[model samples]
Target chain A: MICGRTPDELIRDIEGFHGFVAPGLVIGAFMVDLAREHIGQNTEADAVVETRHCLPDAVQILTPCTVGNGWLKIADLDKFALTLYDRHTFAGFRVWLDLNKAKAHPNVYNWFMGLVSKKDLPKEILIPAIFDAGRDILSVKPVTVRAEFAKREKKSKIAVCPACNEAYAAAQGTPCLACQGKDYYHTGS
Target chain B: MICGRTPDELIRDIEGFHGFVAPGLVIGAFMVDLAREHIGQNTEADAVVETRHCLPDAVQILTPCTVGNGWLKIADLDKFALTLYDRHTFAGFRVWLDLNKAKAHPNVYNWFMGLVSKKDLPKEILIPAIFDAGRDILSVKPVTVRAEFAKREKKSKIAVCPACNEAYAAAQGTPCLACQGKDYYHTGS
Candidate 1:
């Protein structure tokens, strides 16, 4: 079982939430479950998803952490890992699939290492293999969130951009992001 | 039509990728299409997604830019907007739903303003309203990406964290993120 449900059941839920059963979601379920086991159920927790892909969706489905709620932050460091910590204490567990250990599990390694393309992936075999290997292929490290990173930024003052006539964070100052040279389009001549 | 596909056709594709037809995706479809029309075809492009939600998926579906390719960057500034630019010139269009204009379309206004909860949303009505409103509720601005922001960060040197025995960007300096107190868990006593 993965995330307290059988792999089949979990896949259905993941499909409903993530559109398709991403291998990252399947693997992330194991990582999340392992971290939660270490943290226990009584404390308030927050998450730091280290990537922007399917792993963030896994955290959203398995934990209270979500992008909209500000409890989850996607750092996009390009690591297929995450940390779940006590909101009050800023103490948490970091979990990642250990590539070295995954070598023993060819299916997991193949997917993680990009040995097979998505269209050619054998999902039927991959799902069960992931469930069987479970957290055996993961690495966990205890960590404390940095003080500077833990503190939430206060709401900044708002200002209207002179160029676009739209409101923006006054802290960014002057014109607005579009006018400040971060625009994505040029006005047609 | 949204993104050169009929609403029904687009919805099916979106369902396969994003799980559901989010109103933001529907609105973002109009926003992305408008931006594309301004930029025209046959140009190398990159995108900066101002938020970390459905809009990025819309860009991924409609454009060649994607996070994996470093062509799309999700800034997560909490704005429901995006910028698509010429890769070489960094000149592009900024597109966002104008709240003031949205007031005329109740469904669009309700969703953007959070006047109704997701479970209670009327998808049958909302999808049509978005198509009818199209780019009418959107505001566009021509922008040039700031030189600093446009440049990609070079791959930094790698170092092993003394504390955690894990690899991290050497540029972050000493110990690594988990060792530097950016950790999410504390070691058990």
Candidate 2:
């Protein structure tokens, strides 16, 4: 109905060319599927379908990083493997193994996500959150402490050297003699 | 004028209390500096700040995805260093390195950014496109060969099946049909 070829025919073709004929590369299969489905037939929802071209291997794609074995290497698609992308789409058929075969890798617990800077330049993108599997369970955060912050008991008023202790309250515009000493250094800039 | 204390005084106090004084650990000195300027002072803006708290040659806060003195090790920051979360006071510091390190480590990347099929979840976050200084480069993408759509320049078609000698049609997938049958793969797929 969609492309003159019924879903059965399409499935047969896929079984023959993609499943039976094609080698292990997902890109080509995905491209063919995309060209047929989205670009050709336009049967599926636009947002869910993605057609990626000239994409690097997962390990290669994640360059400037230090992990390995990023690809979903397999002899066939039956390997309920590969996350983050559609199973049938070649564009989504990504592998994460290290092409280098040396060092190794995960995402959630280890990765740093999108960047939002003050020095603006380009358009912004919507990025989802990530979490790795089996290896790490803790979450990455800013500066959290292991202990809770409890109120400190108040102490009697004492003078702290402005030269060494930046915490002390100082007189307005008054220079302390501690700062005048040879090794004196200012604490509260 | 601005909170009465000079920036220099604060810097000294920070240095004195760092490591030698605090001992257990705090964020890196540079990260602390960033936090002070971006978090400690800008209280009117974002509400929170946290960090993985890893430093160099000292107490290592080995959490999930921590960032350390990468710029210092790679090269000095000459007014421009890649900072991933220097602006987001709530997200924490070391975003630049944490993100890059995620590229290097997917378990952590996944732990922090992986998305899985679920209900009522916050949604998945596949963090492949990280910051390149600022640009969103897919650090996880693999090595790709640039292809041309408009022109067919190079030795265009792949060689025919070596065993069968049949002019391989585009229909047969990668690693030529001849090879697959004979256990020899081609680039077709």
Candidate 3:
């Protein structure tokens, strides 16, 4: 074949094909379908695939050299780190696949990715070693929660959405009782 | 979204697709493009895509898991047996891209595919992989080769159709022949 670049180059290029592959599972497909529902195409296996709007940010698998960093950096990619183990080897591409699936979960993908950082590995070889032992697909799930979250009081006990802390609403009870007592009149007090 | 089938049914039905997340790089894109190309809606990506038509016998990756063997198989997808390196992974997918490119340049892609197949972990992996890897819309060129063939018999030396491998005739001996011993024929054979 009249190739203009090396095979290595081709492999790397494929990794750069962005805005194409989706990360969500069934929900992802539903979203894709929803996004394209009006278009009315994409019905067959070979339909013109229209990407979903505003889903999880894309992720990238770093090369082998950067793998030793232990914990992966959660950044613009909006990713999470995860682990996978099967009957056979521990090291292989399976690690990346598992992390990828998790990242798509929204609830857990990012949460788990936060846990596994450089601190987890002593040798920092876990990442590369796994990718190095390449398997077709990662056939494992995310890490299990060892300890259950403690039950806490709810909005019924006290209304929240306090003033100033727009990110989190305060529990309501005292004062104006509009925004968890954070009314403008009660704000200064 | 109001999906046609229940989530459980969708999970059990679609061949590949997890809940809402998509997996793999370019795989989904490739399938989407394939659907479009087949239906004649593929347009925009044509500038970057280098495609060719090929008729290959469809092969299966997994089977009944009983007495009957699978129709096709691809050795582990990694480039090497040591670790799960992204650089080493996806060998099976690469073969498909190679095959489509080969089909375009009938004389060349095949010979080139054969060259790389020699180094593959297991010889058997080549067939299934070459099919599974599928076609590619290369962002750029990745390979080029120079082949020099030396033919012994004059009757066999012909200008053949590179796409279809059809043979044709050229000039007769002495009238256009520069030498008495060496000659070239134009034959589809």
Candidate 4:
């Protein structure tokens, strides 16, 4: 069971949290389970997810770490892996799917290698393959978070933006980021 | 209306998607509405969210850009701002709360300024303040996305990690990121 939930329970949670049951979410459950096992189950943890995909939802569902709480960080490195570390000590485990090991499971290997697109690879088959392979396809390792990452950032001084007069982190400098041109909306017709 | 949804509809969507109606999500609705209005309603777009907070959900709900689709880029600058740009030309708009404008609405100013913590700030008062102020509190500006950000990235060649035998982005080098030391799990006893 991942996150102390039965397969049925986990599926319901995923459907509710992610709006669907994704393959990455299933695999991520195993990855998270392995990491939590190596670390003490009850340890307060911070998570760094390596992709912007389904894995982030898995971490959010199974642990206290979440994007909103700032306990979870999305590195978006495009790797399907995650690290769960102690909040205070910065010690943790990095877990990822071992591609070589996956070779033993043809269905998983095909999906992981992207030899077949998800549309072509039937979910009925893929989901079972994922469950059959489970944690057998993962690799876990001990790691100490780098010093820079370990340091907790103090809240920045709030300043009024001269341009829009909005409050913003003063560290971003002058007139605020939107006014400085790192913005996304354009009102000029 | 935000995303063509009435306030009640938007709130229901927020509850379903985020499991709650966060104050930021409510404010984000107005921010997105103002951007979409300026950028044209039907334009194909990409988004860059400046925070990992409630604003990302607002963009996801209102626009086609989503974290899963590679269209929404989370810069996590910790600013409560977002930018929506044309997918092809990378020309777009940036929208942020105008702190000065918010000053006209006392409840919004207090909440935006964090003069009172959420625990002390009543949601009944805060929610109505956000709705009353709405698009009136936003500032929208034209922007051209930087060249580096505009370039569409090609899929990376996959390589085998020698240490864990996992398939990883070849550019990350030899043993893969986990073996290279930027890992989060600790399996060592």
- Using alpha carbons, what is the TM-score of model 1? 0.62
In candidate 2, what are the lDDT values of residues B1-189, reduced to their tens digit?
112324344334333323222211221223333433443444421111111112321111111111111111211111111122212222222212234443464432333332222242222222111111112211211111112211222312323345533323334565454356421111211
The predicted structure with the larger DockQ, 2 or 4, is 4
Tell me the TM-score of each prediction against the true structure: 0.62, 0.17, 0.16, 0.76
- Which scores greater on DockQ, model 1 or model 3? 1
What candidate 2 gets wrong by more than 4 Å, as runs, is: A1-189, B1-121, B124-153, B157-165, B169-177, B180-189
Residues A1-189 of candidate 1: C-alpha lDDT, one tens digit per residue: 566777778888777666577777888899989889888888788888776667777876777665534567776455678888888888888898776788899987777666676677688888778878889889987878765666555535555577765645667768677577664344552
Candidate 4 has an interface RMSD (Å) of 4.0
Question: What TM-score is obtained for chain B in each of the predicted models?
Answer: 0.90, 0.19, 0.20, 0.94
Q: Could you give the interface RMSD of candidate 1 in angstroms?
A: 5.8
Report every candidate's CA lDDT.
0.73, 0.23, 0.22, 0.78
lDDT of 4 by residue, B1-189 (tens): 776889999999777666677888999988888888887977887888787777877876677665644677777456888888888888888887877788899888888777887787799889988888988888888877775875556657777777766677888878788678765343452
> DockQ of each model against the real complex?
0.14, 0.02, 0.01, 0.29
True contacts kept of 1: 0.13
Summing lDDT over every window of 10 consecutive residues in candidate 4 chain B, give the lowest-scoring window.
B180-189
lDDT of 2: 0.23
| Docking band of candidate 4 | acceptable
Candidate number with greatest lDDT: 4
Candidate 1 global lDDT: 0.73
